[model samples]
Structures are given as C-alpha cells and as structure tokens.
Target: MKFSIERGALLRAVARAQSVVERRNTIPILANVLIEAEGDEVHFRATDLDIEVVDKAPAKVERAGATTVNAVTFHEIVRKLPDGALVNLTDDGASGRLSVEAGRSHFALATLPRQDFPVMANAEYSANFAAPAPVLRRLFDKSKFAISTEETRYYLNGVYMHVAEANSGRVLRCVATDGHRLARIDAGLPDGAETMPGVIVPRKAVNELRKLLEDDDMEIAVSVSETKIRFATPEITLTSKVIDGTFPDYTRVIPTNNQKRLEVDASDFAKAVDRVATVSSERSRAVKLQLDEDRLILSVNAPDAGNAEEELVVAYSDEKLEIGFNAKYLLEIASQVDRENAVFLFNSSGDPTLMREGSDDSAVYVVMPMRV
Candidate 1:
C-alpha cells in the first residue's frame, strides 16, 4: 500500500488513532493501527477491543492496499516531521515493514497483516439523530466529572444519556454520579430522538468524543443501539460498547424539598472553598458552610494541619443551616456554573444539597454532605 498525505493531516489522523490503541496489549494487531489507502483517502483505524476510532484524511493513493503498523510509532514519526511537508507511506506485501518518508527523514516500521485487525461489529441502531457540536459538548462536559470510577458498580462509571420529561416538556438529559456528587444536564431534544434508548457512555469514550466536539459549527451524527453507541462526523467515527449494567435510580437522590436557598457568586464561592480547604487534612478535605440570613462563612478545621476560614455575603433568607462537603466536589460543581450566581438549596445538614445556576433548572447538581 502506498499513499502521500500532507504532514498536518497525517499527524492529526494518526494522533487520534494512536490514542485509541492500548499501550500494553495482549494481542499484536490490537496495538497497531490499520492503514488503508484507496479512493483518494487514507483510513487509519485503531481499537482496544472495546472502543474503536477511524480517522480519514485526504491522500494521494498510488497503490490500493492495506497494512497495519504500531500506532504510537507512526504517530510519533509523523508528529516530528516538518510541518507542511508531504509524507509518503509505502508497504510492499512481502517486506514485513512499512516505509515512512518525509523530506529528509525516513523510517521503516514493522507491519502487521491488516486482515488481523478486529473491527467492531456494526449494530442495528434503534435511534439516529443529529445534534450540534456545542450542544453535545455541554451535555458531556458538564456531567462527565461526576462519573464514578468504582469498578464494582460498573453502571455508575459512565454518563447516562436518555430522554426525560423536564418542566418545559421533553428534553435530552445526561446524568452522572459517584455517590458523593452528581451532575445532571439537559438540552433541547433533537428531532427523531424521541425513541432513543438510554445508554451509559463509558468514561474513556466520553473523553475521546470530546476531541470531536471542538468545532462549534460541526453537527454530529449519533447512532445508538441496545449494546453499542456510535458518533460520526465527515472524517472521523467513534464506536463503543455501552456499559452492560443498569444505572442506579438517580431521581430519588435529587432533593426536591430543599427550601433554604443561598445565592452566591460561583467563582468567589469556589475560590473561598479552595483557600480555606488548604489547611484541611489530605484524607478529608472538607469545608463547612455556615448559612444565616444573608451571611455565609466557609471554614476548614484540621487538628494537625491547623485551620482556615473565609466569609462571604450571600443572598439567604431561610433559617440558619450548617453543612459540610468535600472541598474538591464543591469546587468542581461550582465551576460548572457559567452564570455569575450559583444557587444552593438545603434541606438539612444530613440530606443531600442541591445546586444550580441562579434560575436555570436546565443544569442541576446534587452533592452529598459529609460530617464536619
């Protein structure tokens, strides 16, 4: 197989492919990317058994054939090549090596038979829809931070994407929780997505998908089935198996009756929590929030490390309440608020507290309280 592609285009495609390739591989072919040259475009495909990524770049295909080479090595070589230089890749079926040439640099990488590459089986999607890149980015970025890393409860290790009934009617919702905190974000439902089945997108897949959402004007085509989910664009395609377990019933944990409302500037609140928590023990980086009338005081106490406190004025009219929460969780949750003010609703020190943008119910967060 032989192809000539621009250095920039080749590097971008190979970089994405290499990321999908596992560094430690039990199978030889799985560690390599399948490079196929044909029909004026070259395709680079890589997989780690569970997730597969295919990147296409325009190229001059002089020979129509396919081969596999170490994804990381190919990416490194292309990345170091001079920018704007044309890269040529050639493989003669019997040489057992793929030749990479660019300007004054040349290298030959060991090759694997493309026939051994495992392509994920295609699924009959139950729902297919198109969503703007920005919309999809917000849904995943906001909720992904809360995805649980615990392996035993495998279902909680991904963001749950499904259709839900919001106050304004049907909307697309993404929810993620690790028991300590939860993020739930909603976007307007796209056409033809009404019958979409809820799917738990794995953490790795969520991160890989982020690379595709950088273009604000791009529209992503999403396909979902019972077992697989696929996101595709004009030049790249990402597919992964959905988690096999059912996510916990999260609605039960979102506080509905929390009456105490405290509206505070999110940036200031996050910075205050960060500063005071510096004195807390590493094991328990907890910050206590004291609320009364229009005043809120954040303090952290650690017997061995000393203590720190910060006070801020907020809009609070309900009865006084004191609650403790992990400083990291508070910082992450607070940063998600794009608006100036973040509203916190509290029921008691023992119950989970709820937070959201000033008056926007579209994106909400629930954080469990800890003992001070």
Candidate 2:
C-alpha cells in the first residue's frame, strides 16, 4: 500500500485509532493498526477484541493495498514529523516492512498481514437516530464520573443509557452510580429513538466516545442493537459490545420527599470542601455540614492530622440541619453544577442527599452520607 497524506491529518486519524489498541496484547495483530489505501482516502482501523475504532483521512493514493503495523510506533513517528510536511507510507507486500517517509526523516516498521486482523461483524441495529453533539456530550459528561470501577458488579461499570419519562415528557437519559454517589442527566429524545434499547456503555467506550463529541455543532449518528452499539461521525466510527447485565432500578434511590433546601455558590462550596478535606485522614475524608437559618459551616476533624472549619453564608430557611458526607463525593458533585448556585435537598443525616443546578431538574445528583 502506498499513499501520501498531510502530517496533521495523518496524526489525527492514527491517534484516534491507536487509542483503542492496548499496549500489551496476547495476539500480535491486535497490537497493530490495519492501514488500507484506496481511491482518494486511507483507513486506519484498530481493535482490542471488545472495542474497535476506524478513522479515515484524505490521501493521495499511489497504490491500492493494505497492511498492519504497530499502532503506537506509527503514531509516534507521525507525531514527531513537521507540522505541514506530507507523509508517504509504502508497503511492497513482500518486504515484511512498511516504509514511512516525511521530509528528511524516514523509518521502516514491521508489518503484519492485514488478513489476520479481526473485524467485528456488522450488527442489525434495532434503533438508529441522530443527536446534536452538545446534547450527547452533556448526557455522557455529567454522568460518567460516577461510573463504577468495581468488576464484580459488572453492570455498574458503565453509564446506563436509555429512554425514560421525565416531568416534561419523554427524554433520553444517562445514569451512572458507584453505590456511594449517582449522576442522572437527561436530554430531549431525538426522533426515531423511541424504541432504542437501553444499553450499558462500558466505561472505556464512554471515555473514548467523548473525544468525538467536542464539536458542538456536529451531528452524531448513533445505532444500537441488543448486544452492541455504534457511534459514527463523518470520518470515524466506533463500535463496542454492550455490557451483558441489567442495571438496577435507580428510582428508589433518588429522594423525592426531601424538602430541606440549601442553596450555595457551587464553586465556593467545592473550594471549601477541598480546603476542609485537606486535614482529613485518607481512610475517612468526611466533612460535616452544619446549617442554620442562613449560615452553613463546613468542618473536618482528624485526630492524627488536624481539624479545619469554614463558614459560608447560604440560602437556607428550613430547620437547622447537620449532615455528614464524603468530602470527595461532595466536591465532585458540586463541580458538576456549572451554574452559579447548587441546590441541595436533605431529609436527614442518614439518608442520601440530592443536589441539582439552581432549579434545573434535568441534571440531578444523589450522594450517600457518611457518619462523621
């Protein structure tokens, strides 16, 4: 295969594909990216058995052929090349090496037969829909932080994406939880997505997919089946197997009766939590929140380390309430509230607390309290 592509275009395409290739692979071919040159474009494909990503870039093709080469090595070489230099990739099919040439730099990388690369079979999608990039970005970005890392409860290791009824109407939702905290975000459902099957998008896939949603105006075509899901842009496509498990019904965990409301500046609250948490022991970084008519005091006490206390004026009118929570959880949830004020509803010190941005119910968070 032989082709010439601009360095910027080559690097971007290869970087996207190579991220799916793990550093260590049991199968040699799995560690390489399949490079195919044809017509006026070149395709870079990489997979790690469970997930696959393919990216295409415009190129001047000299020969129509395909080969596989170490994804990491090729990416590094292209990354170091001069910004506007044109890159030439050539493989003779018998030399067992791929030649990369750019300006004054040249290198030969060992190649594997393209026929050995495993490509996932095409799936029959039950639902296909188009969503604005910003909408999809908000859904995943807000909830992914709570995705579980525990492997035993595999179902909890990803964001649960599905269609559900919200107060306004039917909405697309993404929910993630790690037992201690949960994030629930909703967006208006797109047309033709009413029958979309709920899928647990694995954590790795969720992170990689975020990279494609940076362009707010871009439209993403999403396809989903019972066992697999695919997200496609104009030049890239990502496919992955859905987690084989059922997500727990999270409605019961979200408090609907809590009436104690405390509104505070989200940024200030997060910074206060961070300062107080500095004196907390690693094992139990708990912060106690004391609320009065319109005052809130955050305090942390660690026998071995020290004690910290900070007071902030807030909007609270209910009966005085004192609650304890994991400082880290509070900080994370607070940061998600991009708006100026974060509204918190509390039932008691022992029950889970609910938080939202100002008056927005579309994006809500639930955090379990810890005994201080």
Candidate 3:
C-alpha cells in the first residue's frame, strides 16, 4: 500500500482510530491499525473486539493496497512530523514492514497482515435516525458522568439510551447512574426513531462518540440494533456492541414529590463544594449542606485533617434543612447546571434530592444523601 496524505489530515484520522485501540492487547493484530488506500481516499480502521472505529481521509494514492501497522507507533510518528509536510506510507508486502516518510524523517514499522484484523459483521439496524450534533452531545455529555465503573453490574457501566414519553411528548433520553447519583437527560426525538429499542451504550463508546460530536452543526447518522450501535459522520464511523443486559427501571429512583426548594448559583455552589472537599478525608469526602431560609452553609469536617466551611446566600423559602452528600458527586452534578441557578428539590435529609438548571426539566439529576 502506498499513499500520500497531508500531515494534518493523516494525524486527525489516525488519532481517532488509535484512541479505540487498547494499549494492552492479548491479540497481536488487535493492536494494529488497518490502513487501506484506494482511489482518492485512505481508511484508518482500529478495533478491540467490541468496538471499531474507521476514519477516512482524502489522500493521493500512488498504488491502491492495504496493510496494518502498530496504531500507537504510527500515531506518534505522524504527530512529530513537521506541520504541513506530506506523509508517504508504503508497504511492499514481502518486507513485512510499513515505511513512513516525511520531509526529513523516515521510519519503518513492522506490519501485520491485514487479513488478520477482525471486523465486526454488518448489522441490520432496527432503527436509524439523524440528529443534530449538539442534541446528541448534550444527551451524552450530561449523563455520562454518572455511568458506573463497576464491571460486575455491566448494565450500569454505560448510558441507557432509548425513546421515552416526556411531559411534552416522545423524546430521546439518556440515563446513567452509579447508585449514589443518577442523571437523566431528554432531547426531542428525531424522525424514524419512535420504535428504537433501548440500548446500554458502553462507557467507552459513549466517550468515543463524544469526540465525533464536537462539531456543533454537524449532523450525525445513528443506527441502532439489538446488539450493536453505530454513530457515523461524513468522515468517521464508530461501531460498538451494546451491553447485553437490562437496565434497571430508573423511574422509581427519581424523586417525585420533593417539596423543599433551594436555588443557588451553580458555579458558586460547585466552587464551595470543591474548596470544602479539600479538607475532607480521602476515603469519605463528605460535605454537609446546612440550609436555613435564604442562607446555605457548606462545611466539611475530617478529624484526621482540618475542617472547611463556606456560606453563600441562596434562594430558599421552605423549612430549614440539613443534608450531607459526597463532595465528588455534588461537584459533578452541579457542573451539569449550565444556567446561572441550580434548582434543588429536597424531601428530607434521608431521601434522594433532585436538581436541575433553573426551571429546565429536560435535564434532571438525582443524588442520594450521605451521613456526614
């Protein structure tokens, strides 16, 4: 395989594909990025059994052929090359090596046979739809923070994406939880997505998809099946196996009749939580929030370390309330509130609390309280 591609274009494509390649791979070919050059384009494909990402870049093809090379090494070489220098990649098949040449630097990397790369079989999608990049980004970005990292409960290790009924109408939703906190975000359902089956998009795929949705105005084509999901842009396609498990019915976990209300500046609240958390013990970073009328005081007390306290004037009218929560969880949920005020609803110090950005119900967060 031989092709010449601009440094910027080649780097971008290889970077995207390489990110999906795991650093430690039991399979030799799994560590390689498959490079296929044909016509006027070159394809960089990488996979780790469960997930596959293919990136296409325009290139001047000297000979149409395909080969595989270590993704990490190829990416590092291209990243260090002089900016704007044309990169030439060539493989003669017999040498079992791939040659990378730039203006004044050249390196040859061992090549793996392209035939050994495992490609996921094509899936018949039950639902296919298009959504604005911003819409998809918001859905995943708001909820991904709550995705569980526990491998035992694999179902909870990803964002649960599905169609559901909202107050306004049917909407596309993404919900994630790690038992202590939960995030549910809703977006207007796009056409042809009404019958979409709910799927748990693994945390890795959610993260990879975020990179593709960075362009706010770009439209993304999404395809969903029972076992696989695909998000495609004009230049890249990301495919992953859906977590084959059922997500818990999260509705019961969301507080419904929490009456005590408190509204505070989201940024200020997050900062206070972060500051107080510094003095907390590493094992349990607990922060106590004491609310009375329109005043809110945040304090952290760790016997081993020192203590911290901060007070901020907030909007609260209900009876006085005192609650304790994990400092990390508070900071994460508070950061999701982009608006000036974060509206929090509380039932009691023992029950789950709900929070949202101003009066927006489209994105709601539930955080379970902790004992200080």
TM-score of each: 0.99, 0.99, 0.98
Q: List the residue pairs that clash in candidate 2.
A: none
Identify the runs in model 2 with alpha carbons over 4 angstroms from their true place: 281-284
- State in Å the error of residue 42, model 1: 0.4
TM-score (C-alpha, index-matched) for candidate 1: 0.99
lDDT tens digits, residue span 113-212, model 1: 8889898998999999999999999999999999999998899999999999999999999999999999999999999899999999999999999999
Task: Quote the positional error of residue 146 for candidate 1 in Å.
Answer: 0.5
User: How many residue pairs of model 1 clash at the backbone?
Assistant: 0
lDDT of each: 0.94, 0.95, 0.95
Model 3: per-residue lDDT, tens digit, 1-372? 789999999999999999999999789999999999999999999999999999999999999999999999999999999999999999999999899999879899999899998989999999999999999999999999999999899999999999999999999999999999999999999998998999999999999999999998899999999999999999999999999999999999998999999999999999989998998658457899999989999999988889999999999998889999988899999999889999999999999999999999999999999986
| Displacement of the residue 159 alpha carbon in candidate 1, Å | 0.5
